[model samples]
Target chain A: MELITWPDERLRRVADVIDVFDKALREQASKLEAVMRAGPAAVGIAAPQVGWLQRLVIVDVTARKGTNNGLLILLNPEIVQWQGSVIGREGCLSVPEYTGNVVRAAELVIEAQDLYGESCRYEASGFEARVIQHELDHLDGLLFTDRIVSRRSDLFLRQGGA
Target chain B: MAEHWFMLTVVGRDRAGIVAQLAQTLFRAGADFGEASMLRLGGNFTIMLMVHFPAGEHSLAESIKAVAEHLQLRVHIDPIDSHLHENEAADVVVSISGADQAGIVAGVTTRLAAVGLDILNLDSTVAGSEASPVYVMRIEGRAREGIEALEPVIAELQREGLDAVLHPVDMLIA
Candidate 1:
């Protein structure tokens, strides 16, 4: 599965919700994980990012130091509740070469389906929560650039070799 | 054919509809807004925009001049070269905060320049009371040198009574 880059019409289209927990949904989830792991420094990826048009996302921050939540595979994830707010810098695989400061919920409670199709709820905070929000935006046809707090002073180009 | 790109800046006392008025004029003149930054600093509102005009519009400057006059704002327009240039990703994001003092911005930016780091985006605010203003600055920049090279600059900022910290900006998703 090839990761869709920015300005690709596929990235902007709202993804379809995953209702059937069948073999195809499981296969797509595996492909999303494979594509995300193939990229360097990628902690999370969504189904729409790979042109699947399904509500599936994978997040793993275990490789990153100072972060919790080893690995999470959320299907049809939704933010059930949230509180507080913090501004943090974010970059996306789809929108390469640029990063922006975005305001996100400091902590959030999310409900999603597991690989086995069982509904589960979890609370996440700090970097974990931030990653979840970033991936969730993809399901809604939103990019980090769309949520930049201040375009003039908040957006930046990634330096070479970064 | 390459597109014509120009930088437009508008600055004036804070008022409503400044953007709407200017945008209407630009739209009527066949210009597309690219990346833009608009903010309120102190009592003045400033807008810096990159605009793209159609290939054959040579009178865009004149039209913008008329709009500037009608809006009672200071405007500056300059043509930019039509070349595709990409900035390197920044390695660190620095935050500095302390009592407001003179030359803080100049002092910090100069040190960054000496270390071969290009400032990608900078935002500073003076808060607190009128008598005791606290200055805070957030800067994102790409380090041409290694991240360790910024240690001395951070130390110097602290010695000058400003608290400064630098963190690496990870772009792993790309």
Candidate 2:
């Protein structure tokens, strides 16, 4: 799967919601996982970023030291409930040039479907929650750059493998 | 369509509708707004913007000057190179905070330069009473050498009675 970069019109298109849970879906999820792991410090990836217009994302933050769930493969993921707010720095693969400080819901309840078409719901907080929200934005064609607190102060270039 | 771009800076005492008035003038001139930075420092509000106008129009600076005069604000406009682009992603975000003191910016920035890091963007403010103000600055920049090179600089700043931390800018998403 090819990773779509910024300025590509496909990156701006809202992805289609997944309805059928089949082998194709599983294969797509696996491909996304491989791409995410290929990066230096990637924890999450979205379908649109791989040139697929589907509401799918893969998140795994167990490698980092903190509170986290091992791995989450979400299809049509939705933030059912959220509370509080926290500001943190975020960088995206599609927008590889810069990182920005974005305010995100500190804790959230996300609902999605597993590979077997089984429903899954999870409660997450801290960096794990931030990764989910960042990936979810891709389903609606929104980027972290769009949610930056301030263009003049919040935005910066990612340096040294960022 | 032919277009011309200019960097405009305005500074004056803070007041209502200053932005609206300037925007109106630009609107009437058929100019488009680009990246802009506006802030209120003390009692003065300063604005800097990149404006694009259709080529062959009347002088944008002259028109803006008239509006600036009416609003009692100082304005400066200069032609800018539109081909310029933003720099690559920075390696770390450096934050510094302490009791307000003279030469804090100079001391910190100069130290950073010595380590081969460029200050891409910096925002600083002094809060609290005039007698005991607090200074806070957030700087983002790339390390020309590497992260290892910045460790000593951070330590030096800490020794100077300032709290400093350098955070790596990680690409969280693939």
Candidate 3:
């Protein structure tokens, strides 16, 4: 599936509330999981990335499984409580090839729905928690670029030619 | 495949060519890096790197001796195997950012001290406007023994108006 381009309008609108858990929705989520697994070192994916602005996300840290923390998905996610501020660098597939150091909550207790609309709660920390917060912000139409503390502090220009 | 682990330490006076010269020495001795953490505070350059190689490919003791002679830097190496590789420690990751102030580190470490946390690694940098610096700190270490439940105490520090976060280190895939 081709990535949704910037300014596609779908990226900005408040994503549609996922109200149904029918086969079509499940199929869409499966495609998202496939895309996420195939992408470069990504831990999460959102609907807007594929031009579907339904409140949905999927994440699995199983690629590094010895830590006993992996595989999570959030549909219509909402962060109910957050404590502490953390500064870390993040990269996005949508932005593609640019990374910025942005500050986010070190831990969060979030409420979200699953693909089947069953409610789930997530309490995460470290990089896993960061990934959740980053993707959820995308549902609200916010990108990491907006949360970046500064252009130079966390931003890096990847070397290409040299 | 032969596997060996060693705790390697490098300390020398701060200078521009230290890392380059050290890298050349390591390359010549054929030591592969397993994990590395380095810092420059005040005038001292301190380095701790975990290195590994095939079980019998090289003698770690002899390699350290050669690198020490070549680089003229204080270097120490200790060998360990599967039973004592120090795999059982927890880690705490802290992130802090605010309009830079002089007391940022003081405030953070003070809290950690009150909670009985022993910091193992810390990396911090400052950026932002010249007038107002944005200070960030990332810490990796095990939570202090017997004080694993102090996250809320740490959380309370947020009310003082600095962006602070503390959490257990999670799957560092890279």
For residues B3-31, write the lDDT of model 2, one tens digit per residue: 47788889999999899999999889788
Q: Quality of candidate 2's docking, in CAPRI categories?
A: acceptable
Candidate 1 residue-wise lDDT, B88-135, digit = tens: 566688888899999989989999889977887788899789999999
C-alpha lDDT of all candidate models, in order: 0.80, 0.82, 0.67
CA error at residue A82 for candidate 1, angstroms: 7.0
Off by over 4 Å in 1: A4-26, A38-40, A67-71, A76-86, A95-98, A104-125, A137-162, B1-3, B54-58, B82-89, B126-134, B170-174
Listed per model, the TM-scores of chain A against the true chain A are 0.89, 0.91, 0.86
For A21-119, candidate 1 gives per-residue lDDT tens digits of 888778878888999988768889998898888888999988766757678999899999999886667778898767667878989999999977899
Clashes of each: 8, 7, 8
* Top DockQ prediction, candidate number: 2
**Any runs in candidate 2 off by more than 4 Å, and if so which?**
A1-19, A27-43, A48-54, A60-72, A76-85, A91-99, A105-112, A118-128, A140-147, A150-162, B1-3, B54-58, B84-87, B171-174
**TM-score per candidate, chains pooled:** 0.76, 0.76, 0.47
**lDDT tens digits, residue span A109-133, model 3:** 8898877789988787756777888
Give the docking tier of candidate 3: incorrect
Say which candidate scores most in lDDT.
2
lDDT of 3 by residue, B119-165 (tens): 66566777687787787676545566544655765676577777766
